[model samples]
Target: MDKDARDFINEYIASLPWLTIIESVNDTLVEDNYVGKIVIQSFKGDVEIMITIPQDFPLKGIQFMCIGITGYPHLMPNGLLCLNVAPAGNLAGELQEHFSKLRTWMMDYYESGKQDAHFEYYIFDADPKITFVFEEDGQKTRPAHCCGRFSYTSLRQQEISDERVWLVTGIGDTPSRFSATFMSFHQPTYEGLYFLLSRPPMINVNQGLTEYEDLLLLLTEEQKGYFFSTAASISIRSGYQTGCIVIVGYEIPSLQSGLQELRWEPFFISLQEYPLKRDPITDEIIVRPSSVSRIHWCKGINASYERMFGRGRLCSELTSSKILVMGVGAVGSQLAHSLVRGGCRYIDISDSDKIEPGNICRSAYTFVKTDIPKVQELFNQLVGISPHLEMQFNIAIEPILDSNKGYEKLKMYFSKYDFIFDCTTNKHLSIMLDGMQLPGRIINLSISNMARHMVVITGVSQIHVLKNRIYNKISPDKREPFYPETGCWSPTFEASNSDIAAPLHYVINELNYRLEKQLIIASFMIVREEMNHSLAYELTYDL
Candidate 1:
């Protein structure tokens, strides 16, 4: 016999409470040929296991039977244990290594007397989500060793008649393969409860498995009221060659009515092919990926989206409003793209600036003619993807004060719009629109720091209205004279002098830089505003 088989047998024998060695098999006497029956009569108050092993076992593996009702792998008909590790078909080959590990596990169970006992649990009532972080210290600092997020549901029973079930539909960054167990119970008697643990079949991708694949367990009303305490263990092995392991635990529902609680604790084991390192210049931590890293990262985007949002509610509130993008420049272009991908349908865009060679890096409409205005070019691009999209082009026109006839044009253009976006940094233009007191909300976006910085500010008339009411102060006049020194677009120009050029270099770069910064700020403001809207709706429901 191989050393591994001998070690397995020894470990299995050590775990049993009693072992009876049968002297002979089939009434034939063979040297060193004996059968052993090991029995675990009692474990942790209510579980038992029985095993029969033929000495010089024919298959070099032990055959075990579970007689009790509480432990895992509840025996089915035909004397086959429904163990997760013993699935049928090709997938069964994947468990060979785990089988070897289980042999050693029996020894560990004997030495330790029980499985790892540490657990951490979290219950998020507002979000109706439960999270478990299983670790030695309950900290989630290291991703390599940490179990990723696992979403769970909560069920409550009121006197076994009234029941409430809440499902956890969305989760972030969960593992590809997982399992679950459900324990349900009612009030008063906590000891007698029905429980069900299930390990579903593995869901595989084209060649690999999905990262968000998980098991769902269902329980009946009888199970909920009778089963008092439940425990679940989840193991996740990363598909990458690094082979990180994340183990988690969760306490099943308790019978007591007032406030049932569930929690999670996680454990992490690292399997790195190479050592991690820190960059000398950037001081950023980096881990070298094994050869299989690329394969794991090459999953389909559709699959990923399905895994994350398939069970969650669609964001209907986000779809109700239209997003108007005024400029298709660097910042406005990116914002429009992001908004479209985020599920906004109705978009209106405008930009007077023409497409130049330098605009390619910043603008989404890269296949435009050199002389086409950015707005017209971007409109064509957007319409190509969505033929019925609403769009307008007020290209090559500079915004001027109402006293100069430009205000009438601006008013006509903005009359039907829900929101006005200012992607241009021209102070004169901003001042003119601010003065007109446009009927709709105005969102101003700018960029700075080489396109990295952005600021977004929504100019709502409510603030002006509130200021007027509270302080009895008239809001400052919207129209202000452009200052020559501080203004981004200079007034000095000589149309007749063909040889003389305007201060183009300084103005263009500065305008782009400041707009980037303003756009960043605007992005934050928009997100906060949306979140506030969501909260307000939630509060209204509570009321």
Candidate 2:
């Protein structure tokens, strides 16, 4: 019977042009009462589709329709087939109209034979829900369920010492009544309770209660235990409303047991009216609302601010400040170390060069070995010294010249800083930084050739100094060249000379100038002069 049905379906398919587009067909017999059949079809327009079916002989004409088409109208999983033959829902009523058009589409696919095509399809009744179960670590348990109730009139009457006055106020206001109930099976600590209530979908604990009447009280130990062991309830009365209440409590184990035994568990119970139900085993009853709603408490300011400051100074003494270091070399390093020792936190360090062996003579990293990435190593070292310090290092100065790239990053880095430093010898970088319209004070330091001498400059912005008289006081021509050779002494001139030069000419010159007469010292003096001038200018400008 299966063989006859297969032959008939094959004939029917063969009669259609679409079926000719199919490249290969295969059938496999299974040992367990079933056969698997597959049809692989290659369409002309770079489209190929393979269809598989169980050989049950079509009870519903077709078991599965897997149509692969070229770029034309595209096959969709929905029965509303999109084909060039009919634009809409394949609504052609006549059998000839539908079959002829389908055959034509197949013929087109067979004839086109082009391969540059994309695939898109829609499947009807696709199950959107994920069916497979996946294992995940740390799944959160559901929050303990809770409800609340309060009666405004009953609460007011309870508060009243004079019945006539209470009646007058209650009748005059026609006060809206309120009640609240909360249930939990876990007895979270006081801290945990605050945390749970502080999160969204609950009350904002940060904003304390506005009215003195807003209060919370701990229910009796029996009531608390009753709430945690089972579903329990409470009854509350306020001026406005009354309803069922659920209560939760948290307990910390005694210090003798330590934190190992500390557990935060919740107990839940409901309260509707009158005397609350008591559990038999624990002998704990549901808490009355009046007993748990009259306590007045709030988070302290000092405690809140302490949480904000983390490991820093007392909240009252804390101030937003900045430290600027001009050069990121040895002396600057030592100075930074000193400042950190002095309790100055938050520093900005800048250097444009990778650590080199040549820099060892005077660099802070001289004792340290070579090949270490300097900025990061220095950062780690500084952080080790003072973990609270916020330090930033900028390795590139070119970006500073290219305003588009540099300004934004620099502005963000320096926006809230209180000080700036110029430890760099790169004239362009220094000048560019000095030229910036800064909100904080500027400090600069540089070492003469080697570590023989050092100079420090402190100044304010040019705008503050000049008072709009002239924006820039220092001219481009006045700025010192970065390289030693380009400075006052030219290497070319020294090289051209004979008797004055030695065998290792440049090295001898450097040693002679730096070591003998102390050229580095002299340069440091020059830097000191520049610093003095800068400080003078800042002072004058401030005036």
| Residues 373-459, model 1: lDDT tens digits | 777666655544332234456664466767875568767766666566676656555666667677766766653322222334455
Clashes of 2: 59
Candidate 2 per-residue lDDT over residues 230-328, each given as its tens digit? 332222222112422221212222222232111111111123332334557776554344433321221111111112233543211112356766556
CA shift of 172, model 1, Å: 43
* Superposition TM-score, candidate 1 onto the true structure: 0.31
> lDDT of candidate 2?
0.35
What residue runs in model 1 are displaced by over 4 Å at the alpha carbon? 1-318, 367-371, 384-388, 404-406, 460-543
